[model samples]
Target chain A: MINRKSAAALIIGDEILSGKTLDTNTQTLAKHLVRMGVTLQKTETIRDSVDIISEAVKRLSESHDMVFTSGGIGPTLDDLTYEGVAKAFGLNLLKHEATIARMHEIQPNLVLNEARLRMATLPEKCDAIWTGGLWVPLVCVHNVYVLPGIPRLFSSMIESIPSDHFGDVPPRERKILWCDLAEGDLAATLDKAAKEYDVAIGSYPATNNDSKKLYRTMVTVEGDEADIVIAAAEQLKGALNARYGTV
Target chain B: MINRKSAAALIIGDEILSGKTLDTNTQTLAKHLVRMGVTLQKTETIRDSVDIISEAVKRLSESHDMVFTSGGIGPTLDDLTYEGVAKAFGLNLLKHEATIARMHEIQPNLVLNEARLRMATLPEKCDAIWTGGLWVPLVCVHNVYVLPGIPRLFSSMIESIPSDHFGDVPPRERKILWCDLAEGDLAATLDKAAKEYDVAIGSYPATNNDSKKLYRTMVTVEGDEADIVIAAAEQLKGALNARYGTV
Candidate 1:
């Protein structure tokens, strides 16, 4: 049996809950993690409260193999991720000389004000994961990886993550079938097909917009057995095609 | 002092976690709920597992004044929201005759297969919030309101929800100050200003894109006291300008 790794994301932001900003970090992390064979179990978006962030971090870290947190790591008043992580692990916050040195190296003319220097302070005993090219590094405190919420920065930092972060399990293979029939029309056929395979089947019916396909279904087959996953995809295709015309 | 109402949203779907679908329902509900004096406290996205869904619903409902759930309430095998909601409330699942009648009324020639008819299976005791003309209605089980995931249907259903659903708290007044200062530069100013006012002040710094603004910070002052919210916005604007030389 393949040992599957599980992960969860903690998106810390008041902007997200207030509808002032749309959070794409969760989706980005999910896609990246899924492609790496890590099952993203749950994602929670909470307000930027230090106590709540600390509690959630500790809880998620205990339950999941790996916990990725986005947002709240910025150099601002609302950026309390470091403090939260410190509280969760009962570690003291310390200013790292390396981070400060790197910051100066990257932004030579930038003022090193109290606010800017705040980024150097992080949870004690945490390793900085940097790609050498980027000045900012993602902080890893135990099983929790603290990443900035900015989409570009988050993606860049994630790319620097080591290959072993996802563990030894193979990535999932997905097959999608776009059907002309509405989800209601294809319900029975999908039900039968889903029961036949041990794969994860998802049905997403799009709202009537100007989109070409009325509905789309994705079949994810991931496990140690590659042949079974491929075979299931073939069977699903045949079944769906037979019932409703494929788009 | 104003009594603040709180809400949380549960987005249930495997597709969302798989990165196949982007959930806008959370934001849609957040924007609408905020206008009604309801502060959306948190939002969670979990796979379509009955146990997980039920647990999340129960937990969220207890913590929040109102809970809105989106997705997994469709007519498919994976559509397990009704079951989850029922389990959360410890209520028996019954085929709601009203829902069945509405389903048939909407899709007259549609064949009501067992899978399709599954949409009609709701919790034993619940109120259906419906618009006069729309056949599909949002299900309300205790403090949890079940709305479908589809954007169009979810929005339409939410519109039918009674105004009293968000409680009698007076709507908050909001004032925003857009500044060109980076979040790091204005952290101390924002922190000091936030403590001085009763309003909820949030500083959101946007990532630099191709847009004209290199950096954008949104200072949001929201509270029942219009005078305080407005004064804080003015104070924040002055502080930011003095500190960063506003763009």
Candidate 2:
């Protein structure tokens, strides 16, 4: 049977919305989720607001099997991931002694002031997935995994997660074919093939930035059945070539 | 008065969600919106599914002053933006002669097959915003603006958008200060300053990939009142310097 697990990403940070920082976490998470046979269905980027965070988490969690949240987990005033997630689940925010211990281990000489200690507070009934030494563990509350927004930290934490966390299934097979013709000219064939085949097909009309080719159409087919997906791709290529000549 | 006409982006594409393509449209739009004094409140990346597209467009259109959508407007089987937005507004899809004429102008030598004609279909009761010749005009349905997914095309379309569309206000003033100290150590002070001043402050802890400094904290203050925003920045800087010498 095909794996049906679906995931969504909630990327929270004022910096991203202000265009001060570029978000790579969504793309990173999507790649990993796909590797685990889970489809990343949607991603939302919002500011560091508690109300927005809580509402998005609640809604996404109800619809998806897993929801990953990146950012607002730091020890700054704007970091409200713990509080917002707790409010969403109706849980109290409590200090995690283990997290505090890990923090001390990371920076033994640093003072554990109120601000530094803030990172220790997490939603009640949450579990921490410790990746390795000196790094903060990823927090898991219900179906949502709270991750740091820092690209390096987020990537490392995700790397440490067991590949089995998202379950397993037959890997999806995809094949892409390129045609020089306008995608509009091939839309009817694509529409017909999509209905007849069991594969999901996508047609992209792209303009090369530096290449001599002004326009190229990319047709992609993805499905669990490799043979069927490949067949669909080949059929699409044939139709495009038949009408507009191959690129 | 401050311009509070905020907007949100709906980036629709399977390539983005499947980790096949990186989405830069969100950042591009955010920067442009900020320059025009329109805050980009949120952005969502969803699949090419008609149901998902319609729901997101309808919901965001109701909440935001303006909603911009990129992708899924092409002439492919998966290109459901026209159909989706129409469904959301309870409008019928109709063939527009102007759009058809423009398509022909863009490719005068090509035959207008059923697939090619698909590009002429659009939602009724909508107005077109033509940027220039030979390009498909951006469609405006209610508060939503549908645009192409191609980066070059999207950038050009956005740039061609009337500057007066978002309304004008006193340009926001921003000041960023970098500190070598851990952001956690300065959270409390940052929080206090944000409440005391009529400015928004954000603390970002970043790790330098190629610099000697392992970590640097970025403190940003932004507001319509230039004096208040700058004062907040200076105050925060003084507090940080008092605690840890400036970098």
Candidate 3:
């Protein structure tokens, strides 16, 4: 493989934990990081409570190269990510003038009430990076990047972060071996090949989408080194003795 | 509010971390626990590693009343939940005759290879709960329940667990106030009503599904008692001065 910087994601929202909303941010961040050649080490989904957010931020930021936090940054009552992140770093929240200016630019005649002003409040020593002609700023405190819960805003903000910000990792090559053999029957061969190869080999059973199994089992062998990855997959395919025949 | 037990979920799989798969298990468990009147407090997603699983199980199980783990229990090489659970409890995995019998019943004349036998081998203190005519067991080690990652099997296995297993909690009532006001405009009012009433009130801005906004903002007032829940929603509606009027 190649040397790659690792990152973790912290998703903050009560809607996710209560089953009221499905979390798409983690997946978005994951796929984005993959394209940037950064490995997403871990992800956590938690409620919007300040204590929980603060603790998770501290924990995740300590372990990984950087941490990306999604949600809980709106002007609503439940939005407490700024306060939580500030508390995590022993800093304070300050109303950022740039954020208010951007907000006024978007709404033109926005009423600068306490409710609207809450969006301008950010952690001390943090940078409010604006983008996409949207008023919402992607707040960065140290290595922790705080983002909004809205999917549109989250996706654009993540995309705007420069690829070099995560250092550089060359893209990896991947190959797949498909077979009619069920996961149980295909397990032993995969185990053997994985031990002999330096690549990541994963076996996935075909899932029933709407109770209909539409595909056969698939085994993936992937690594930054293309030659070894391809060789590993080729070896597995050649040695396979499929009771149900190869797919 | 009525008394309720809280639970945490630990989801394990490399595919999830690598963005190769989207996780629906956390949502499934969250919705299921909601039906049982149990509160799901937190959810964590991590790579498929023995040490990571073992540590997460210990930490989550200690903090919450119970914990549910999804994935890494298959017969594949990467399946490591049993080993992790055993390490967490200082127990050893032992081969179970019942699981082998079930495997035979499902795929008669099945070979009991090491890979297949791995499915029958479980933690010493764990209880293998069978359901839905599937050979895969819902292995429970004390307050931690390990389940398969596949959505279809995860859904069915979670349903088979008895309600009383989580202890009894009367159902909670929920009421909602829909409005055309944007989230920034609705924030202050929600903050006021949530503080006044002893209820969990959450404000959600409308999302753009396929880049099209299909609905307006929604505010939920929920608690164990119906009287106060409805009162909270109604009070917010009466006090609401919607610039766009209430939806």
Candidate 4:
């Protein structure tokens, strides 16, 4: 199966930076990308200023194969993601006829006012992917996927993306071992296993839900090969003397 | 009262980027910073690589008056934040006697293993804020505050910091106006108030919690001064002709 291997997320909003809003888009995008075997390397949350947005989009787009931006794609004055993206590519913001046509197709009685028409103005060099019968198409400019800030819409747009649109990936696997010892106590054991197995292992101090389950540290072993990942997890489980293999 | 005017958060972790953990420290920092009239300009969540951590910390520190980092400050092999910070300033990682002493003070019979002792090794030049009767000091190197990844510990460490520790403040006030109209419909009104009143205004589409309250769009008005924020909210409240001021 074709999949994107490396990705980055850029969350654009003043509300998020201002603490007026909590961004769930990063996690949503993360879960979806992980399922596609895409490793989300970094996420940058910045204000809605066009200057800030353009600079960040340019920087992130250059580093990762696929870049996903959430928020500030609406019709408001604060919605400057389209302009920022256009600026990032040194393009012009032009009214998109397809988006306008799709808007009418979705809502026959829609009043195409100045504000509503503002949504049609997008980067000159972008393609719009209309999916799931939604009027607002997923705007693609280069490697960046410009999505709306709304949780429901953003998630649906991501879900509708075809896998081939990405790059490539090997089927990855994850295994978690629950250990009662403190993270420090399991550190040396984790280090030895990680060095020997040559797999991605992470030790996390448990909290909230994990704590409720009487779990202390959750050691995760992951790799592109299932056999290797499993072998590493087993080694760590035995080395740490962990009883519960809770992957 | 002194308060830092601008802040940035650097979240260092593999679990967060790998979608294994959701980061709540940014919001916790934002809320606290906003209360002190400090604008959290940006938040960057990256992997637990030393190079990535060092580069991000250095860049963010230069941009903001205060920088806070969450995660990657443990005893495991993956814990590389301290090394990253020291590398950022070209400083050496040295053992701190004060941290070791405090650890003994907290737990007299504790074993200072190589793993646990790793926590005591901080940057060469930094102040250790011993607070909340906790052995682990809040390591402050330059403008960056290196904090633990655990949500509870991170929150308590932040709470323990005195207000005077910051630069300056003028008591921020926030007011939200809940309207039963779409965000697009309220766009013009929000824009006008923002331009006219010279206050920070944000328009958010109602989420799960706000939707349960029968609210559609939440327009927030905030400023360092209370009177201007209220006046702007009042103007927007009247201009939008919304009867419900939810804040």
Query: Candidate 2 has what TM-score?
Result: 0.92
The residue-by-residue lDDT of candidate 1 on A168-218, one tens digit each, is: 567776665666566777777766766776666667765655254444543
- Say what the RMSD of model 3 is: 3.2
The positional error of residue A188 in candidate 4, measured at the CA in angstroms, is 1.0
Clashes of 2: 0
In terms of docking quality, model 4 is medium
Instruction: Kindly list the per-residue Cα lDDT of model 3 for residues B1-247, writing each as its tens digit.
Output: 4678989999898788777778988989987887788889999998888999899898888899889999988889788988998898889999978888899899798788888899899998678778878988888888999999999999999998877887877667776666767777778888888899889988878777522243367777778888887788888888764322232
lDDT of 2 by residue, A138-224 (tens): 889888999998888888888777766787575588787767766877778888998999989887776545243544677777898
What shift in Å separates residue A16 of candidate 4 from its native position after superposition? 1.0
* Ten-residue stretch with the least lDDT total in model 1 chain A: A238-247
Per-residue CA lDDT of candidate 4, range A1-247, in tens? 2345678999999888766677888888887887788889999999889999999999889988889999998777888899999999999989999989888889888778777888999999788877777998799999999998888898889988888765446546888888888988888888888888868889888886453376788888888778888888877777875754643
As a TM-score, model 4 comes out at 0.95
Worst 10 residues of 4 chain B by lDDT: B205-214
lDDT, candidate 1, at B136:
65
DockQ (CA atoms), all models? 0.62, 0.57, 0.60, 0.70
Instruction: Tell me the TM-score of candidate 4's A chain.
Output: 0.93
- In candidate 2, the residue pairs with backbone N, CA or C atoms under 3 Å apart (3 or more residues apart, or in different chains) clash, namely none
Model 4 stretches with alpha carbons more than 4 Å out: A1-4, A243-247, B1-4, B243-247
Give the interface-residue alpha carbon RMSD of model 2.
Answer: 3.1
TM-score of chain B of 2: 0.89
Q: Is the docking of candidate 1 incorrect, acceptable, medium or high quality?
A: medium
